[model samples]
Target: MRGAIAAMVLTFLAGSAAAQDLQARLNDYPTEARADYVFGCMAVNGQGRDVLRKCSCSIDVIASLLPYEKYVEAETVLSMQQVGGERMSIFRTAAPAKALVADLRRAQAEAEILCF
Candidate 1:
């Protein structure tokens, strides 16, 4: 009986640690990046209090779905795609770049469904 109680305590501690780790990962996006996302989302959706809430929720969902590094890679690819140069063509045409963008897009889509 004592062993069972100890095992339960250990299990609960392990679960708490796991939850904290997941929360830290989900919050890996920098404040600036999260703000930028929310602002862009609000601009596209609308500038209102409710829009603010939804936009915040959207970024949170995206952060939960994607890591900060992956998000940055996808954003960089998208920005590079806009430059008018032969070098920029790689971002526009490369499979790897497309895949990064697709991952970000999928996260955003999931965020949309959840938040809006």
Candidate 2:
């Protein structure tokens, strides 16, 4: 009986650790960043309550698919690409920058399919 009880306790502890790891991964995206994504999404989609829910879902999908650091890198590359100057041309033409943006776009596409 004692051996069975010990096995059950070990199983419970393992499950708890797994849950904590999952929670940490899910929370990698900061609240402000998530809010920014949802607000931008809502602006393009709509301002209704249902749109809010969808936008929130979209960001959650994105957060699940892409790490925050990669997301930020892609965002920076995109923002830089928007600038009209020789100095900013690298953002438009560089292979690394393109790859970063491509990863972000793929994540967004996945999010769109799943959320909307």
Pairs that clash in candidate 1: none
CA lDDT, every model vs. true structure? 0.95, 0.92
Q: Give the per-residue lDDT digits (tens) of candidate 1, residues 1-116.
A: 99999999999999999999999999999999999999998889999999999999999999999999999999999999889989789999999999999999999999989999
Off by over 4 Å in 2: 1-7
Candidate 1 RMSD to the correct structure: 1.2
Per-model root-mean-square deviation over C-alphas: 1.2, 1.7
If candidate 2 were superposed on the true structure by all CA atoms, what would the RMSD be? 1.7
Off by over 4 Å in 1: none
Clashing pairs in 2: none
User: Candidate 2 lDDT (Cα, whole model)?
Assistant: 0.92
